[model samples]
Target chain A: MLLAKIRGTLVSTQKVETLDGLTFFICEQLDIDGKPLGKYVVAADSVGAGVGEVVLYVTGSCGRYTDTTTNRPCDATIIAIVDMLDVDGKTVYNKTDDA
Target chain B: MLLAKIRGTLVSTQKVETLDGLTFFICEQLDIDGKPLGKYVVAADSVGAGVGEVVLYVTGSCGRYTDTTTNRPCDATIIAIVDMLDVDGKTVYNKTDDA
Candidate 1:
């Protein structure tokens, strides 16, 4: 799993049928400090995460473990909503701090 | 899918039963020109990719798309062995060139 922030949404009208009804979010990869790393991923929303929300995303086949992605072609999926992030015993991100 | 080079192998004696008989390989992420970027991933071998071979790996739910990874907890899986890599219509890596 990796830390990322929801950047935006992706509305694909012509994706494969297996991806129907799955919501997609644009997530920016974040470093341990919660800073953006300029890399972006389009992840299936399995946890109802909204834009600007910090999330923990799992990639590969783990993305398919959820009901929304089962047997789907998704390679990235947001698995958890992060309320706070602690790295090396330091609180790096707190969702309540968002403005 | 992303390009990567098999670096090493991982043997686990206590992994979940769903992962039994699955071979894991350490893969280094590769750039378009086939240079290692120093990031590593442990991928379940869906294909019989050998060490030092370049492969295309799929992450997240797509990793489970293969028969070997179906219903497994695998997140990254090697899908194909690369015979060559063409970047911008230029040949960057050729398996025949390996000496």
Candidate 2:
């Protein structure tokens, strides 16, 4: 899992039928300090995260292995909202720092 | 399968509960002349990508294995939609030049 920020949204008109109701968001990978890493992804939002929200996302197969993505064409799903992140015993995020 | 770009998008509403209408995007991670090597992701669109376009994603479990991401819970789902991408041999992208 990695820390990232919600940058924008992606809109697709003609796509797979199963994707019909599914929403897609534009994301950018972030560093430990919550800085833009400069990579992009379109993931299935399993958690209710909005723009500018610092989120925790899973990659590879874990991203799609959700009840909502079952048998759906999805990859890179937001698994949690990430209230706080501790790396090497350090508080990278506090959710109260006022971002 | 690396090379990526997209900017943001993440909207969660209480999450889980089978994730109502799965969709998330906010990616970063690009090189190969595309620039922006930041880290970020949240994907689930199978095609028809917008927001600066330039898409192509896949992760761990084949980005949810396709067929609409079998077994719910997705991973990383954009299986196709890259008009032209070639590494080593050159030509990173060629949807008709000019990005």
Candidate 3:
């Protein structure tokens, strides 16, 4: 899994049939320090995360493991909304601080 | 799936039991224009790609769908050796030419 920030929502009606009813979000990859990596991914939303929320996402076929994306061609899926991130015993990000 | 160049092989004696006997390779991501993208991945080799070969790799759970990686914890797998790459009606790379 990797960390990202939900940047915005994406709505596409002309997508593959299996992806219908799944919400997509534009996500910007985040480094461990909660800084943007300048890379982005369009991911299916499984956790109902809002824009500006840091999230944990899984890519590749593992993205299909979630109920909303099961057996779909979705390559990225938001699996969890991060509450806090700690690395090396130091707090790197906390949702409360941003909220 | 993505394009990558096989840079070298990897040998690990202390790895997860499921990953034992699997051959790993160091791969460098490649752009559509056949240029290096400055990113790298350690991938399990399923296609017996040699060093310096351009290969196609699959990440996530799909990496485990192959016979050699089935039910393994692998996140990346080299699935195919690329003979040529074409984009926008132009040949971007040809393995024979490189050879």
Candidate 4:
């Protein structure tokens, strides 16, 4: 799992049949310090993360373990909305701070 | 899965027990044009690729789906050795040419 920030939503009608009804988000990878890494991924939204919210995402086949993405060709999926991030015992990011 | 060039081998004796007996390779990711993408991954070798060989590597949980990597904590695995790579109707890479 890695940290990312939701940038926006994606709606594609002509996608693999199994992906229908699942929302997708445009995510920018974030470093531990909560800064964007400039790399991006389009990921299926399993946790309903809003734009600018930090999320924990799983890539590759692990993305399919979620019930909504099971057996799908989905390569990335937002698995959790991060509430706080602590690195080296120091608080780096707290969802409440952004709220 | 993506294309990568084997750069070297990796041997870690103190790793997750499930990863024992699996050969690992250091790989550099390649673009469709066969140029290095500047990203690297340490992947378990499933196909016995030698250094400098172009191979197909799968990342994430899919890496654990292979017989050699099943139930392991591997995040990457080389699945196939590329014999040739063609892009835009042009031959981009050929193993024989390198040999």
Q: lDDT scores for all predictions?
A: 0.76, 0.64, 0.76, 0.74
Best by TM-score: 2
Which window of ten consecutive residues has the lowest lDDT sum in model 2 chain B? B80-89
Cα shift from native, residue A25, model 1 (Å): 22
Q: Model 2 in CAPRI terms: which quality? A: incorrect
For every model in order, the TM-score on chain A comes to: 0.94, 0.88, 0.96, 0.96
Error of 2 at A26 (Å): 1.3
Instruction: Compare the candidates by DockQ and give the number of the best one.
Output: 2
- Report the C-alpha lDDT of model 3 over A1-99, residue by residue, as the tens digit: 999887655433332345568776657789999888967666779987887889999988788898877765556789999999999999999899998
Tens-digit per-residue lDDT, B9-77, candidate 3: 888798899888888999998865667889999999876678998876667776676667878988887
Docking class of 3: incorrect
Candidate 1, residue A94: CA error in Å? 41
- DockQ score of candidate 4? 0.06
- DockQ for model 3 equals 0.06
**Residue range A1-99, candidate 1, lDDT tens digits:** 988887665433322445668876657789999778966556789998887888999876677788888877567789999998888999888988975
Task: State the iRMSD of every prediction, in order shown.
Answer: 9.6, 7.9, 10.6, 11.0
Docking class of 4: incorrect
Candidate 3: lDDT of A27?
75
TM-score of 1: 0.54
The TM-score of predicted model 3 comes to 0.54
lDDT of 4: 0.74
Model 4, range B1-99, lDDT digits (tens) per residue? 899887655433322334458776657789998888966566778877787789998888787788887755456788999999888899999999989
